[model samples]
Target chain A: MIEVKDISKRYGDGTVALGGVSFSIDKKITSIIGKNGAGKTTLLRILSTQLAPSSGTALINSHDLIKNADEIRKIIVSVPQEAKPIQYISASDFVRMYLSARGFGISEAKAAAEKALRKVGLWEFRDKLTAELSGGMKRKVFVATALASDADVIFLDEPTTGLDPFSRIEIWHAIKALRGQVILTTHYMEEAQALSDDVIMMDRGKILSKGSVNELLKGFDGLVRVEGRKRRKMAYKVGDVYVSYVDRRKAAKFINEGEIIRPIMLDDLFIKRGVNLES
Target chain B: MNLRYVAGYAWFAGVHSVKENYPYLIAHLALPLSLIFIVGVLSHGALLPFALAGGTVMAIASDGAGTAQELTYLRLEYMYQDFIVATKTGPIDYMLGEIFAGLPWVTPSIILYFALDAVYGMLTLYNLVMTLIVSVLLVVSVSSLAFLLSSRMKHARLIGPYSLIFSYAMTVLPPTFYPFNYLPRWLVTTLAVFPTTPAAVLEQGFFGLEPTAWYMLGILALEALVYFAMARSFTRWREK
Candidate 1:
């Protein structure tokens, strides 16, 4: 459980990464979804104890982020977006070493490393150097560390980015199997929809919405998205295309043959509300 | 500081660095060995003692300063600093881990120079122990400065040149390769600002080349404490 209170972060050059925002998280998995520069990573970093909030503070598992950062650190693990394994170290060694640094004994670290590498489907490649592994496998090495950790919470910053579809699904399952709180930031709406118990949508430096998948998509019961150039009774201009959200019965009238028509996704939240994400 | 985390990280990082970058290990030896060669060939062994003592001090100080690049790379490019910040690892654990990680690169050079010191008939039990003490102090002081330098570095590209400037200015600009007695008293006092100056002076005293100035040993220890304290307080382990 986490409670963020009026947290704001402003850099030295006057860049406000996070505005005054307050929210509480009590989900098994919560995904922060936003476009680039939406303050998603900034917020994750602040909560993970890697960055200090400029104005306010947060309580992670009842420990204050600033006042009790050291205690908080013992209960959390974060995999940064740009994190890469040391090239020369084997995957098994990297994970084991990470566990060791987290205070696990040698045998304990080895067992945890084996279990984690197996979960991420890299147990067979455990002895191979990270540089010898594929890009996706290297990413899995980091995920394995998170899986091996006994921490109460795990923060992943875009863990599945740049991975192939199969690799992404594998990582999704690994994350799903993790117990306790897992907070992640991702740009993929499908990822947020599929894995997160709750989704927190952000725009600029503020929270736009927060709810379960079904709750967030409650209003679009029988609606489908018809994307094309034709104007409809209810449509919003998204870049060069017009996305019209209509009842399934009325969607046929607006769509021409071979035009794009798909089921409604969480992205429609922006289009239905006339919010252009690309802008 | 969590000593357990520090020791674990030091072993992990140190072993891996040596294995993966074995070829680059020679980078640490090339400069000192080259200086020894130049001094040996030109002076026909007359000034071999200066090269032996100065080369050893230079190697230790430059290696200490060069650790900034490793810290910067770990922080900015690999994001290892952020990854570990969420662990039980503290700032002091990370700093000591990085300093010890660089030891494997410098260890062979230290042994070689000490062996050379023995061959040149300057090695004694007391000199050996005192030189080792001075070497450790030099590393702590210069590496603390390196930690400070890396913490303020924003870009990885800038760290390479910046650390080079640091190594040269702190190790070479000081009269590390020559006798302190060669310079005037005013210049000696002025150049003592660099840790390498006192470190070299202390080493020269241990080798019996210069009269043992016990005060220089105090200066090196003081530098280590001041720089270590400054680095402990100033380094940006957590972003604002």
Candidate 2:
């Protein structure tokens, strides 16, 4: 479990990155959704003991983030937004070596590395140099490295950013298979809705909303996405989709031969919070 | 810290790292060998033990700095340090892992030095023992200094050329291949504080043909300890 109380970060020139943010996350997957420069990375970095917060405190498994950082380090693992291979090493070998550095014996490290690679569907290509691998494959290697560690707490910053859909799913599956608490930040609303048990929506370095999927969407209960020729009359445009918070019968009436009507999702909730989805 | 646990697989890990960068290892070894080749061809075995000692330490310092440089890149450019900062890998484990990974890169130089020493009849038991000690100290101290310097930089690639200069100057300008009496008193005092200064002094003396400062050996041991602590303290990871 993790508890963050009023954590704030200000840079050297007095730019506030995070301002009095607080949240408690349990032993479950939580998604932090934010646009670029919303301070998600800063908050995650501070909680993971990679940075010092200008004010406030955080605790992971009852250890103070700053005071017991070394102890915290022993129980956590982090995957950055972009993970580059440290050398041109084989993916599996790199994973094994990192595990070895984590105090695993040869046979145990091999077993763990193999299991992790397989989890990410990379076992067959384990011998490939990371430099030779595809971008998604390299990202999966980072995911495999995180999965192999078996730490109690894991932080992944935009784990699937820039990856294709299939590779994204593969990494999501690998992340799902891990048996520990996970905190992930992403710009993909679908990913947050699909994988997170709870989601925190952030904007301007502050959390705008925190709730489960159903809880967050409760306010948009009457809303439905209507797509077709007639959707323009009673709808608000969201990218190519048309959405409106109205009676289901009214929304369905606008659906034509080529149209589709579906219930509102996290995207509608985000739009309701005054954000333009395209941005 | 369970250093035994770290050692259990660190050697194999080091081997894997070395195996992955075979080109780097080859290139790293080739340069020093080429220099030794040039020395042998020029002096026809004239600069025997001095060349051996100086070249051996030069290889260790230059190549040892590489370990720190690579680690620094991993931390800065790749953010790999963030991946490992958590986990049970202690500082001792990290140091040993890096040092072990770097050792094989310097072994070729060590072998070449010994071959040159044998050809010139400079491989006395005393010189051999003394050279190994001084070489190890120089490797550890200079590598730490490199790590320290690398840690201070925000950008990657700044440490390489600078460390090269530091290693080159530490070996060439010191008393390793030259006589200590050639320097003024102020210069000697300034160079004496360096870990390699005493190393060169002792190596020259071990050959029984040049002046040496036996006390400088103790100073180098002290400097190595201090530099090790500095490296540990300086090379810390921060989100910045």
**What is candidate 1's DockQ?**
0.63
Q: Write the per-residue lDDT of candidate 1 for residues A1-279, one digit (tens) a residue.
A: 999999999998999999988999999999998888989999999999898888999999999988999889888989999688877678998898788678888788889999989888999999888889987888889888988996789999998899898888878998887766999999888999989999998878899889998999999899888888777666789999888777798767555554588888888886676667787
lDDT of each: 0.85, 0.76
Task: List the candidates' TM-scores in order.
Answer: 0.95, 0.87
DockQ of each: 0.63, 0.37
| Local accuracy of candidate 2 as per-residue lDDT tens digits, A1-279 | 899999999999988889899989983899998878788988888887778899999899999987888888778888776768654678888788777656777888889999999888899999887888988888888778778988888899998889999988877888898877999999888899889999998877788889898898887676666654446555666666665566776765656456777777776766767666576
Candidate 1 chain B TM? 0.95
Q: How close is candidate 2 to the true structure, as a TM-score?
A: 0.87
> What tens digits encode model 2's per-residue C-alpha lDDT throughout B1-240?
646435543454456556766787666666456655666677786654466656676577667667667777877888776666666665556665666667776777677777777887777888788888888787778777766776676777776777667766676667655556668968977987667677777777877767666887888898889998887777765654
Share of true Cα-Cα contacts across chains kept by each model: 0.72, 0.50
Native-referenced TM-scores of chain A, all candidate models: 0.96, 0.88
lDDT for each residue of candidate 1 in B113-203, tens digit (9 for 90 to 100): 8898888787799988887888889888888999999999999889988988888877666777667788898888898878989988887
